[model samples]
Target: MNRPSIARPRRPRNHPDRFLECQRAVEDTVVSAIGEASAAGWQKDEIIAAMIAVADDMQLALNAKVLLSVETELGKLMKKYR
Candidate 1:
């Protein structure tokens, strides 16, 4: 009789640092877009400010519960690669 293979379970896919990296990439894109929009005079000041504010919040205002979940999962993934 063959014993069952007990592979270690994978961690959750949502990573906190990954989220932060996404935030950075988004912010960069937003900056480029905002600059182009400003030059083209196609964007409103209030709209631009609102979008930037939302990005900043996502980058910095991460909820503690969610952050813990993400960071723990990331730790597992990192361990897997090592």
Candidate 2:
């Protein structure tokens, strides 16, 4: 049996509006994951630490400015959820 191929949406590299759309998609996914983790009894610190680890892994792909932004936002989120 052969599985059907899934078609992924192609995002335009230079489109300003597409960038916002992608950001919103990422935000939604992260929020959903956090909620699921919380429901699964993960502590707030654990969740935040997991996110930090993910960010650390992403360092190779992210610029310094973006990494700083992510860290700053994670700090804010950690405080908000505490």
Candidate 1, residue 9: lDDT: 27
> In every candidate, how many clashes are there?
0, 0
Once model 1 is optimally superposed onto the true structure by TM-score, how far is the C-alpha of residue 71 displaced, in angstroms? 32
lDDT of 1: 0.67
Candidate 1, poorest ten consecutive residues by summed lDDT: 1-10
List all candidate RMSDs to the true structure: 17.7, 14.8
Clashes by residue pair, model 2: none
Q: Which stretches of candidate 1 lie over 4 Å from their true place?
A: 1-12, 42-44, 49-82
Error of 2 at 20 (Å): 1.8
TM-score of each: 0.37, 0.46
C-alpha positional error of residue 75 in candidate 1 after TM-score superposition, expressed in Å: 39
Winner by lDDT: 2
Ten-residue segment with the worst summed lDDT in candidate 2? 1-10
